[model samples]
Target: MLTTEIREAFLPYCLPDITDEEVNEVVQSLKSGWLAKGPRTIEFEKKFAEYVGAEHAVAMNSCTAALHIALLSANIGPGDEVITTPMTFAASANTIIHVGAVPVFADIDPETGCIDPDEIAKKVTPRTKAIIPVHYSGHSCDLDAIYEIADKHGLFVSEDAAHAIYTRYKGRMIGDNPKGAVSYSFYATKNLSTGEGGMLVTNNEEIANRARVLITHGMSRNAWNRYAKGGSWKYDIEEPGYKYNMFDIQASLGLIQLDRLEEMQQRRAQIADRYNRAFSELAAVKVPTVSEGTTTHSWHLYVLRVNPAELRIDRDQLIEELKERNVGTSVHFIPVHLMTAYSKKFGYKKGDFPNAEAWFENIVSLPLYPSMTDDDVDYVISSVQDIVHKFGK
Candidate 1:
């Protein structure tokens, strides 16, 4: 049981580092009245493209929408198969189903929790139209191998980079290549948040133009421009598309967030370092690892793996103890295959993905956000140590 003092000073699992600048930007957007996908959205797209080293960017309402559009732009549809990891959020796999495509699950590298290139290679078939590699916890996947496989199979590569805004692979940005598109999330808890938004980045002009058209009801131009200067009201719907455009209001927040991204990322790295140093000596906990040649991890989620055999308590009990101590924590994800929707739909069994299932049983995401104070980090570390010492076998 946690003591009253610890409970009173417990830290939140994730906190958005919104500052006065973000608030002011939102206020300014409100006053401008051009709150839809207008100037701010365009500006954000340009800035984001530059930030990610992509040739083009299309802002949308959510990463899910961006991913859906990325697939659609690639002409992926019914009977098409997309390979992805089972260890990620369902959205990564669900986006494939959304487009009438089949999502084939690939096992992850147990160490990094990223889709194993070898597993992805084994799953490829004639119907495999695309491969979606998720950068789990902001750690770069084996892109070298994944891309080589894609090249050999002549398949498209669309990255589910929801956790990799600042991650890099071999000195290149995750989405820098136009051969495949990369989708980023700006959800409230993401590295670069616009409350709830996403962006699709690509170097191919054709895909970029098509994605822009598909995001706005398949119209020739966006609604923000239908009534703007030199823009006519008349338009034609080329293809039926979803309503997934980003509002300028969200872009307002994004602009400021981008400005402070480096500072925020630095803080997150510092916290990760502190946690790593404190937890490295504990045999009951396994800290995340970064591979050689990888640079700039976004530090999105600090997932700690507990050795159940070494500790008397289980992962759930650890979470419960953290809650009891008022130190909020969360699970990075429950593998998609484990969920009822995915299980019954796909006839997936518990042992379908041994690495992912095993990881799920022992993983816990600690409180890891840029806004955490030193004191907050200290509290979380102390609370974790207290639990481990008390419960370790």
Candidate 2:
């Protein structure tokens, strides 16, 4: 074990970068007594839509809810199938099941861990109604190819952009397409921290309106409006819907977080660059790859691949070693097919998604958050190098 004369505390894998402005805004909301979905939520939605260059934005309690409502709005239900990558959070696929649709897994590009458009094309059947491309690790998937496939198949594109809040493809933001609805997350560790919140952005007015109603218990009018001055107490529920509305407290934090997003994103990019430079020459480590024409990446995670043959230790062992050195790390995902729930229910085997399984075997996500200082970054780099030198074949 390597020990330093001056010891540092264990560094967490990810941390939310919150400022006093967020705290103050939340406090103001608390004092206003308009706690539930109200003016602040509405303002956040409007500003988020404008920021993403979308026609409408609906704030929700979670990205899973946003995705579920997006599928519902698209009218994807029983006997329908949604194509998605296996190398993503379970919520991306689970949302399809929530809407009574089948989630068909597609193989990912081995280099990018994003759904391969070609694989998606092959997976389309008569029952396939939509393509849910997940922006894995904040890298924009091949949107042009996926969009082309969607057009040819006449399928909807509901993007699970949980990791791609600020990612862009061909100078256009991820959530700007009308044919596709994009869902974003403001989970505690997301680039933008709202504790637990999400937003759905789309250009179709009808879809937006349907989602708005569906997120608030299917009520025609919200409680804040009905109880406000000169407002009617009458309300109607046209359909059964989930309670997924974002509260003013969450929106208050989001409103300020949005203001700092650009700067935070820059810091993330700098950290990624530093990691790349430090690991580029190492034979055992494989740095992440970006598409040629993409303008900006949100860099939500800095995932590295370890060549088992070059390194005497396996990916899990590397993670264990990092922990021993007081550095935290994580795995982006375990392929859905490998999870007990999916495997047992769907009768899926380990070989079902070879690409996803292969990537999962070698991947580990390093610490890459905006809150990390320069010294923190250097320590991580040094720790990784030391491990490689000690363990490499």
Candidate 3:
């Protein structure tokens, strides 16, 4: 019913909420002359671990690197099968492969768009070494059920918590449980932005120690330790490792972002609530559901599902119409199983995971970020409503 004029410029799906605080921190890091793997990185790790109530946290270059290192540290390799959902970013599965492990595809919950515990239970075998359950779109997966399954089968659980910066399940933060490794992303568009960085949290002392060594090229000590005053140059390479250490420049941004995370998350929650309220009334669209009183959704992405049967236009047409109205949108994922790399490498096909494929056909991620203004939120809502009205069957 809104008749407001269309936005003159395109509205992006998401944007980092950078402020003078972040800029000042980065400037300070630059002026310090210790830009890589220095004091700032260590401080970020400590603060982030405390924030998530984790026993240990290791900073890395990316969430993919964190996952790869976690898998390697767990000794998961060839002939091992790691179960995961197809309805996720490819990095979730690719890291399993990077460690020479096979990624066993599991279908998602039709409603939650998260990995289904039932499907995971069905896929477990003697070859199963771990389960990489992604907290899809910042909604916590059924961790209790997943953990129960893991306990019964003696399987490791490495949470791909790229979208779950502040998400909680059963009154505890996602990384706090720490029975296994939990990886978080501070990607450009995440709830917490560091431009590019990640962290791995775990309760296992051995994994923590190994991750520390592995992130710094398997060196016995990091550069900051050797280069600082009263430092020793003597070091040793304990094992082969990847160059996954996070730099102080990125950590400087992370520190500022972390300081502002709660405020930013509040804004995101408001946007999500507004979107849910507005979209729930539309016949053609289904709003995302949150598990009331059970989990805290990070609200990282407000994914709306279009019931193609009720709309004359399909998901692609909906996206096009929104774009024409200067409203940006995106699909959370295309389902990892359908990607060429997975299909060609693993012999997966179109119908290998039915739920994921079906869900992929109708989901659209709306513009949700702390940077968006109230007018921007209204513009997106009105645009979507206008498009649905024009295209509804």
Give the Å shift of residue 177 in candidate 3.
Answer: 2.9
Q: Pairs clashing in candidate 3?
A: none
TM-score, candidate 1, is 0.97
- lDDT tens string, model 2, 103-156? 899999998999999999999999999999999999999988999999998999
Q: Rank order by lDDT, top first?
A: 3, 2, 1
What C-alpha root-mean-square deviation, in Å, does candidate 1 show against the real structure?
Answer: 1.5
RMSD of each: 1.5, 1.4, 1.1
Model 3 has a clash total of 0
Off by over 4 Å in 3: 1-4, 292-294
Q: Which candidate has the top score in lDDT?
A: 3
Q: Give the per-residue lDDT digits (tens) of candidate 1, residues 10-42.
A: 678998889999999999999998978899999
Task: Kindly list the per-residue Cα lDDT of model 3 for residues 1-393, writing each as its tens digit.
Answer: 446587799999988999999999999999999878899999999999999998899999999999999999899999999999999999999999999999999899898999999999999999999999999999999988999999999999999999998898888888985899999998998999888899999989899999999888798876566887878889899988889999999999999999999999999999999998899999999999786523789998899999987899989999998998898898999999888999999999998889899899999999999989999999998998888888788
Would you list the clashing residue pairs of candidate 1? none
What TM-score, over all chains together, does every model reach? 0.97, 0.98, 0.98
Candidate lDDT scores, in order, read 0.91, 0.91, 0.91
